[model samples]
Target chain A: MNGLKNDGISEIIDGKRVIVKKPELLAPAGTLEKLKIAVRYGADAVYIGGQEYGLRSNAGNFTFEEMKEGVAFAKEYGAKVYVTTNIFAHNENIDGLEDYLRGVGEAGVTGIIVADPLIIETCRRVAPNVEVHLSTQQSLSNWRAVKYWKDEGLDRVVLARETTGEEMRLMKEKVDIEIETFIHGAMCIAYSGRCVLSNHMTARDSNRGGCCQSCRWDYNLVEMEDGAEVAITQEGDSPFAMSPKDLRLLQSIPGLIELGIDSLKIEGRMKSIHYVATVVGVYRKVIDAYCADPENFTIQDEWLEELEKCANRPAAPAFFAGTPGADEQLFGVHGKKASHDFTGLVVDYDKATQMVTLQQRNFFRPGDTVEFFGPNLDTFNQIIGTVVDEDGNELDAARHPLQIVRFKVERPVSKDDMMRKGL
Target chain B: MNKPELLVTPGSVNEIKKQIEAGADAFLIGEQRYGLRLAGEFNRQQVKEAVALAHEHGKKIYVAVNAIFHNEIANELDDYVAFVKGAGADAIVFGDPAVVMAVRETAPGFPLHWSPETIATNYYTANYWGKRGAVRAVLARELSMDAVIETKEQADVQIEVQVHGMTCMFQSKRPLLGHYFEYMGKSMEIQKRQGTQNMLLHDAERSNKYPIYEDANGTHIMSPNDMCIIDELQDLVEAGIDSFKIDGVLQTEEYRIETTKLYRKAIDLCVDQPDQYEEEKEGMLEAAEALQQEHRPLDSGFFFKETVY
Candidate 1:
């Protein structure tokens, strides 16, 4: 296998052999490191945010320098980078946005995803070289909205999470444009940009990037009676939490491919590197497997297991099949812990010394069994026999966060490989 | 012409006549099935009456044909647009391109106002939508006063800003309140596709209670504070905003009428004698403050920098 991942599937179109190559696997990258991991693990494209003008204000967004570096890294695997400028702009927020957008274009970003028309117009005026895609925050549920954006020169529109399966099919039939949908990760209980619970309660504008996720917080039902506020419903039976389970669409890969969707996106920008690699890798493998052989290929059990291992929150299918009801609404606060603990990230492998160097992400003790896996290599189980620091002193456990640790390994593991232990 | 046109949301055709008498220059009305988040969903016959009443009074009536159409809704919209236009509606306010197409195809010369709740943030988008056929743009409530003024100054189309109303912070097609009730194993009657007065959501950790209701368009989670921007009317009038909207979604018909009259007095005072705005605003504020529920305090949303963040 090539070190750089092959992004598209092979297929025939218009009676000729045109690899039925789309439903592009788009991943989210919070930092430059995550961008590299996404490209290597098998993303056709990665959407990221710059330092400003994004909904994820708290995410470790890239600066222009990091964005340029990230773009160059993604280019090695023939992957594309699109920066997110998806904030609902306030008056002050508009200051210096044109220049920021121009800088994104200069960094060779393939496109910019925005929800505001102001950003679209500015990009078209000053950064004409960059493509523009509409963010899902616009809550585009119908074909006309899709067609509307297309009329205004947008390349694609990320369909709202509330977009029903029937609506998606109708949109594809009615509009001739690239359609993207969120297939996995956290789902907003409110339609993406249609929400500002964080803004109202915390005074942090969810639209302008400071979303505190107030919907996930508990609420008590009340009503006004006799011109006085009355508490009609108490929070006891089940908490009045508005958070939904994280989205998982492993079962719907073939349907999306058949639908001719241009891109299948995962929604997480503030997630871990372990999450970026694990989720991207699973989706990539499943998409490839289904594309390679449509009829015989079934969702292997291992893929679901792999998905379950990395879920920092409980995952489910939302509003994809039909209008979800009580089953879809999560009325509790607890996010599911990762089934497996990510122990380390492989930094370098020395064949001469037969040792693998890594930066510790989680604690690992001697005799702890770990599995080493990479984008291009088959996963192999390894026992933590002896761990040594960079100064060559033996250690009982790799405890400090991101501390460099080395151990003897006969198999040749490449850089960016991950090591994990089942919790 | 110096003062912005005062637009009011009337609960019915009868209220349209009453509100016009109370000093509204225009009316926003529609059938419950067509308009997404309206206070009153007038039926077809009522819609016809509304158009006639507004026309008879020399006032404007704009129908809300702004649902995000699925194929079924899209297929039905062309006939609906024609019906409203045939009834002599002044303009059609819509957010979706489907409705845009309907208005374009059915009523070629019908005035269009692109009023997507959150997307119309900047002048560029407003100008772009103007090119697509919106004669006027209803700016998002999220915009600050500076942004609003900039949009009014720079955009090709006329601009309308909500001067007084409730702001919907969240909307979803899923019957969130119904499901939230079901999840709690507590059954409560939630009126669908219409306004309900009894339901409110209180943050368990905090002390804000947001009024929430479900409709055909979806569940709308309104902001806890009543967005009362009557105090900002002078700035809007001075900025030359084409229209001022008073959304009466959850308020009483009397509150709607009273508020409309207060804004009428306020706008007239500002447009007539600009120097008296501060003096006149006190009486306006006294009346506006009286209407406020103690629990649901009034704040001028997003106009000031503190709330804009």
Candidate 2:
């Protein structure tokens, strides 16, 4: 094991010992159910937001009670929960912040992620017991920022998404605090939430979690000439010049582990439970496999295939490899469709009748062939033999969102196993 | 009531004294190294001379070091901060927390102003900065009058809101303009003619056009309408705001001089005739209407309606 110390557990694989350094796999959770799914799928930690002050304001954000339940549920799986209060505070935003901070602290959350300096100071004072992780919104791209935050006594600093793996290694060499970076998710065209295009176009505040995604709008490159306007036409459909491809850094896991990054973050708080489970499960497998043996580490094509099946735009290795250019820019399109549609989620399973109660997400019919997968189970395809509502009335299709519906299957599925319509 | 101070951005070093003579109470300027606006950056010598000129007229000057900094140049920043502090700058306007922390460490008692690129929409954030040693918080340009008033009422820190000027709606750290030029195969040395500082960029799907400019801090796309709230000086005064900013670094000298003088007149009238300020407000509004550029649009941005969405 080159540079791999024995701090990791040794396991016998093919009658040989392998040492593994397992970093925490942190995932994003938009709701309490997603939080449960993420934890069950082997996420060591999950970052979420409360009703107020989270950047994903429109998300089914947790209330104080929900946050308490989430913390307790995650604690059962030995995972941590971090809450976001990362909005840049204006003058009036401070009045009830202390109370919220105190409540979150008392709720036994692992940490609080904040962007504003004053917010960090307030958090330290009001919720001294809770750890404070610097939000990526701070756009901390330098070692000095990391050192400055560490010297100020912050527990961890989530490095900006734009940091290269080389810079990360250098930063880790300089600072002794926990380092977290976005390993996967939708990348912001603007510098990590430092955008106001949404605010000026619509009344939605992007910093306050109301991103209108103005960057993804179809745009034209135009120039002014002689008091007249002319279009800079290209050989394509309308150019989405500002839209960056979603980031997926599955290939760089060994390098990131060698640098000893404290946590690897996945960024999808506003996604469905199926998306969370699929993404977190994939990352967990890859990291664990890599940790078991570094010298023989190999990038698996199956992991990428599984990720492509979830709700995502086309994925590209972002700035981690280098400063992304036209290759990383999405052109002529706003978003790409996933390979499969998330149909439903397993809520309850009656082994005797082979009936599974599910919360329908997308439209699916009685004869649709769907695949079911969870934390401990391999994906298995099952034909939906019958579909009925809560009152046992037969339905042609499960059309509504979050509607309670039951379907007959051949085998029992665990709670939280995601169901997706096969292509 | 005290007259609200007028802060102006001069187009050039020579324009500084003239803007002060036109009744500019203070100056918010920047150097070429770390300032937000690339076109308005003053050399170090000009910065020192400008400070002397402002102080000669009994005015305050704040230097803007508000660019989002990267780690490669982190050491250079400490020297830059020390240089600005030693060069007699009254205060430094910073947006990055790391830079603010550096300043706090370098000059523990220096007057530091927090200018987050994102709007500080509420009072709690300002109070948070106030307790952390920030003397002033410039309210975000998108704030409605009600939010500004609430910020001033609730946050104990000094509040500064842009009352008149172009508002930067989008800022990015990527070298988008350079990249565009490269993509277009255009020469990098294209000489930009005067009066062409504002570049208009539009989307194919949307008819609205935005003004884009780039510098050391990266690209800044501005709102279409120039914010003109000189007519609402009394409302701002009543909201406990005393500092009004006018961004004219990209505007013509004539426009800068006229706008500064118009706000100066409006502030004096509001202080002198509080009960009948409406009469003075009409006169100032007429002055502003007369000073408008022929084809340029202007609006009272988020001033009347609540902008919290």
Pick the TM-score winner: 1
lDDT of each: 0.82, 0.78
Looking at candidate 2, what is the lDDT of residue A135? 93
lDDT tens per residue, model 2, A293-331: 766778888788899898558778878877776557665
For each candidate, what TM-score against the reference? Answer: 0.93, 0.87
B41-152: candidate 2 lDDT, tens digit per residue: 6777788888888888888888888777776656577777887788788888877666766776787777878787465666776776676677998888877788788778
Q: List the residue pairs that clash in candidate 1.
A: A10-A19, A11-A18, A11-A19, A11-A20, B193-B215
Summarize candidate 1's per-residue lDDT along A1-423 as a digit string, tens digits.
011122244455554433366579999999988899999999999999998898887889998999999989988889999999988775566789888988999999999998887788889889998989998888787777677777777898998887766677778787788999999999788777777676667777788887888777777777777778766565355555667888898888777776677899998998888989999999999988877666567888988988887897877778777777677767765587889999999999999998999999999989998988779878788888988999999999999999999998758999999999999
How many clashes in candidate 2?
15
lDDT of 2: 0.78
Tell me the tens digit of each residue's lDDT in model 1 across B160-217.
9987878888877778777776766665554342455667888756777888877787
